[model samples]
Target: MASATEGAGLSVDEESPVSQKREERLRKFRELHFKRNEARKLNHQEVVEEDKRMKLPANWEAKKARLEWELQVDEKKKDCVARGEDYDRVKLLEISAEDAERWERKKKRRNPDPGFSGYAEAQLRQYQRLTRQIQPDMENYARQREECGEDFHPTSNSLIHGTHVPTKEGIDRMVEDVEKQIAKRSKYSRRRAYNDDADIDYINERNAKFNKKAERFYGKYTAEIKQNLERGTAV
Candidate 1:
């Protein structure tokens, strides 16, 4: 009976460790499941917040309808115009003489109105621009003169003819000066990148040029019509 009790006690203690390990694994699995659920909830909330932020522009449908209606009116007007029909439905604004005089005065004020230049104007302007570009480097000039020895004085021709001794420092300085000049030129000579995918409806270069001029003259007045046409919402 005593031996049997000892064996049973040992077996119970051995089974206790196995049960504890299984419980530990179950606790870890439950923790991971809870963490995953919380993560999913957080992601769902973030998505909902993002969707709230991204909303359509206010009254877009009504604005689109109005644009379509205006486009229809413009198309009808153009058709009447092409057919040589009297489309006198639109009323023209009548400006007073005082308003016209005021507008002329405003234009004159806006004009810089530099007085007329004579035959030598181009040459004079070129010289003026060159003079304006002349930035004197007092520090570099003084340092160079000091290093060339006390007795060395610059003759006008010496610096102009590029007769300087070639050294590593001199080459580096020249490179720096060239880079600075390039930087200055780049600021003034920048061109915008051309997008190849833009709507180019013209058949040729001449037609394209005419289209550009036409757009420049009338684009602001017909922006809504253009948008409606592009959206295929034109009546």
Candidate 2:
């Protein structure tokens, strides 16, 4: 039986200088790793505290109420539009003095002329156009009749006829314009992806690009296993 001192001596003798250096390196690595881990933990804690300090405090309840109010109003407007009803602007909350004044000014701007609207102005424009067109033709006809005498009768020969036929170039230009409009519409049209399998082609293409990498990894791992087996080493 070996005594304690003798056993200790044998163990120390079995350990080489290289083994001692390896043990020392392991101890230093453990110490370094522990310090690094502690530093990382401390940094993360500091970041969290900094974020907490920087975040501004707000009235969450009030914010939620305001957002909900806006949503409700938007839904109401949509409902009105869907029903083909006129959208009456409704105030959701009281406005500030400045906002109220701005709203009043906007309303006044909608009808710049106090008693007249855009429709009325358009009607007046149509009436003036008709008067100008009819008056000129009537005056010319009256002058012709006066010069020809009252007994003079009008015939188809007296009426001048005009014919306008588009040239081939003009017709081709118009067709090209129509084709451009059709192309523009088609360009902006969206293709619907309405099924789970709609993106299969894209997924397959992406996977194909990575297939070689996957095969290489598999080959590398198998090669390592084969080498280990030949060397009689445990995997």
* Top candidate by TM-score: 1
Q: What is the C-alpha RMSD of each candidate to the true structure, in Å?
A: 30.3, 26.4
User: TM per model?
Assistant: 0.27, 0.20
Clashes of each: 0, 0
| Candidate 1 worst ten-residue window by lDDT | 86-95
lDDT of each: 0.78, 0.70
Question: Which residue pairs in model 2 clash with each other?
Answer: none
Error of 2 at 153 (Å): 99
Candidate 1 has an lDDT of: 0.78
Model 1 TM-score is: 0.27
- Tens-digit lDDT track for model 2 on 192-214? 44566542323555684476476
lDDT of 2: 0.70
